[model samples]
Target chain A: MELFSIILLLVMGVATIGSAILALTTKKTDVAILAAGAISLFASIFFLVLASPDVAMTEAAIGAGLSTFLFFVILRKTEQNAEK
Target chain B: MLLSIENIALASGILLILIGLLGALTNKNIIRMIVAFSIFDTGVNILIVTFGYMPGRTAPIIDGAKVTAQNIAQVAIDPVPQALVLTAIVIGFGVTALMLVFALKMHEKRKSLDINDYTDLKW
Candidate 1:
């Protein structure tokens, strides 16, 4: 079980790193926002794997849901203003 | 030396922090910087929770049947870090919202997203 857990953690770590790289390097602003949210979603999974279900839920709700929504809303507003 | 859960989380947290710092420092767009800050925030939260992880222990939840109050210390991982990270997650959301608002205002004022345009302190 421990080995299985370790393997899961390693896979998640690799995924988070890959997504972080994507968030940082992506040229599209919308893609970067989505990648940042993906990082949060992956992190919530990490918390669950570490035996912190409460933290995981919170991260998923606020970090992944609300923040990403807010970013998209703000981005839309900014783009609209720019187009005007 | 073992690739335990805590060790893996710690390493990932550190690497994520570095990735966030790199993005924050190098990105010139206001929204991108905000994204980097959000990533940095997650890394910090992960580190906090990882430090409190106890191997072979279940979650800190106590229902008096599975994890009694008496044996919770031995049977469960630390709850304090979970609480801290919980607060951090909400606060991070608030902060990201604030930063987005600020970025919006900046964009409205200058009509640009580049950090170079905001030279209020330029000599």
Candidate 2:
């Protein structure tokens, strides 16, 4: 179990960094927002692996779910105004 | 040196913060900056949670027959960091919301996403 946990942490670290890079370098706001969501989701997994389930759930819900939804809504609204 | 779980998580969290700072510094678009800031916030929260982690302990919550008053001191990690991260998450959300609102207004006024386009405050 220790080995398994270590391996999972390493993989999650790589994935989190990849997503952060994508969020940083992407030109499209949509993709960037999604990447930010990915980062937080991976962090929540980190929390879970570290043995904090409640924090994991809150981070997943607020950081990943609500924040991403809010970003998309703002993007959509601005695009609509631009078209009008 | 041995690579423990905490060290690995700590490294990742610090790397994330650095990446977010780099993005925020180099990105000119307001929305992108907001995204970068959110990434930074997550990194900080990760660090906080990592700080609270114990080597062989689980969560602070008691469920079923696993954790009782007698064994909780031995089994559970600190609960303070969980609460700290929760507050930090809410504050981060508020900060992002405010930034987005500002970005939206700026975009509406300038019709441009680039930071260079805004020179009204330049002296």
Query: How many clashing pairs per prediction, in order?
Result: 0, 0
Q: Tell me each candidate's RMSD, in Å, in order.
A: 1.1, 1.3
lDDT of 2 at B122: 92
What would the TM-scores of all predictions be? 0.97, 0.95
Name the regions of candidate 1 deviating beyond 4 angstroms. none
Q: Per-residue alpha-carbon lDDT of model 2 for B1-123, expressed as tens digits?
A: 367789999999999999999999999987888899999999999999999999978888777589887889899999999988888888888888888888888889878778999999999
Model 2: lDDT to the true structure: 0.90
lDDT of 1 by residue, B38-101 (tens): 9999999999999998888899788889899899888998888889888888888888888899
Best by TM-score: 1
Which DockQ-derived CAPRI band holds candidate 1? high
Candidate 1 structure quality by residue, lDDT tens digits, A1-84: 888889988999999999999998888999999998899999999999999999999999889998999999999999999999
Error of 2 at B70 (Å): 1.2
**Interface RMSD in angstroms for candidate 1:** 0.7
